[model samples]
Target: MNLPPVNIENIDIKLRFGNFVLNVLYVKFGYFLSSMPEHSHSQGSYELHYIPQGKGTLIAQDQSYPITPGTLFMTGPDIIHEQIPDFNDPMAEYCIFFEVLPGDSTPAINRNHIANDRLMSELLMSTPFWIGTDRENMMALFEMLASELSIQSVGFHHTVTNILEIIVIRLVRQYSLHTSSLHPVPLKTLDDSRLLTIENCFLYQYPSITLKKLADNLRLSTRQTERAVRKQYGISFSEKKAQVRMSAASRLLLSTELSIYAIAVQIGYTSQEQFSNAFKRYYGMTATQYKFKRI
Candidate 1:
């Protein structure tokens, strides 16, 4: 049987998302499911990884970073890297692979250059990595991007690209803020027209969303909205919402110290008992048990 759909709606917003062109290669998140040895990306391909929880090690070009909660790392196309998840404490991270389009804004430079004339070019030239202090915001974006790709909803290709653009821009901003460099990366330029309308809706409203409420927010009839969603993901609207909520709950359970009841309410359930039943149905274990298993 086909699985339930992931929630990945987009909406319009006036943020300076990005100016550089980008093409997404792949996006995914979960436990350590692979045992690939050291590998390198194809030409022009780059990788962005976010480790929301657990501990491990990331080795790139012989440079290593301790993978911990809230760690974000970006690697150039030529860098050789190996992901070593702690065997007993395996990590869960969101990874996106893509390539930046050649353009006038990105200076032509050798991949080995640690510094470049332009800030954007320098970012691409060097291996940019960060362990962020506030992870909730970043994890939410990763969750949404993963949702879009996991479902492969209609128009999801474009939606995934849009979200990745935002992620790249955010990283650039972080790099600029911390690095002491001669060139400053432009932070307010944009090139794509895909708005964050539906994405914002799910990000902010997923906790307590109803089909009718969701339809009204998007300004479409309930039936029309349901049809559109079904056409895109092959699942009912309610199923999609539950999937999103459960996904978020799983993340919070692994990363935060919140109590079961608090997490239940945070994800929009009225009571811990209700959330526990639903969680058990979706994950085949209780929330407390799931948390302990990861510990």
Candidate 2:
């Protein structure tokens, strides 16, 4: 069967936990029709697994965990693990390999206030292995990652990296929920400055930015992100995105010698015709007319 791309490697994400940088070594997604040989990660590394479909068994450290659809687990730092897919219904897997290494110190104020990065790092490292069903419905995010990477649209790299960060946060949240030592915290609303930062994403990443991506960046839920946007800008996310794109289009048309098609592609339109239609709707004139009239 045709699968979304697999064996995605060497992705750089600027997600930090205290002085440690979270490095994504690779990501893989496929169905396991056969058994996987026992494997172990090196020191300071983790392999996060999510099973979106089928049944299987994960053997780790001589313990067996029944893997079902929505199972999310992590094997960390030298933990030997293997997977055995059910022949009747083979397991489909999404795996992310990552490492955390010491880096620059964190700033005094933690803007993404779900938890301090130091605490997050401590919690993640403290657990050597975990197996449980996903409560956050993270399959959607994984699917989004697969789609974005496959399409490689404008700002796709940024979207994928942001989604990875959100996955990390969700993983932390799931861990905190089950652990007795810590509890999950509600995400705080973005302040005006932070909201402005999100607005800047709309300005720069107009081609590929979505409300979901913006929410992931802010570490807030999509609904919360929408509310925050409305509160801060007095406009919806789509409206703001369109405004930014059209404004940029107007400037490029006036200042640059690029053709209409080039301007459309640069501003995120898939086709010149599509861009022309949107330009007319926004400006009430054809792009060529606007350019000649203004010039």
Task: List the global CA lDDT of all models.
Answer: 0.60, 0.75
Candidate 1 matches the true fold with a TM-score of 0.45
TM-score of every model versus the real structure: 0.45, 0.57
Looking at model 2, report the run of 10 residues with the lowest lDDT sum: 179-188
Query: How do the residues 1-295 of candidate 1 rate in per-residue lDDT, one tens digit apiece?
Result: 2223233222322222123445454455666644334444433445677877777888766577788878887765445566778877778877665545434444445643323224554555354333444433677787777677777789976786677766776766566333332222222121221112232344467787787886776677889767644533345778767866886787679767999999999989999999999999999999999999956
After superposing candidate 2 on the true structure, give the runs of residues whose Cα lies further than 4 Å from its correct spot.
110-115, 176-295
- Model 1 regions lying over 4 Å from their true place: 1-20, 33-35, 104-122, 125-136, 152-158, 176-295
Per-residue lDDT for 114-187 in model 2, tens only?
A: 25776777778777678887999798999998888777799998898899988988887888433321222213
Which residue pairs in candidate 1 have backbone atoms (N, alpha carbon, C) closer than 3 angstroms, thus clashing? 9-198, 9-199, 10-197, 10-198, 10-199, 11-196, 11-197, 11-198, 12-197
Give the C-alpha miss distance for residue 219 in model 1, angstroms. 48
Q: Give the TM-score of candidate 2.
A: 0.57
lDDT for 150 (candidate 2) = 74
Which 10-residue window of candidate 1 scores lowest in summed lDDT?
A: 186-195
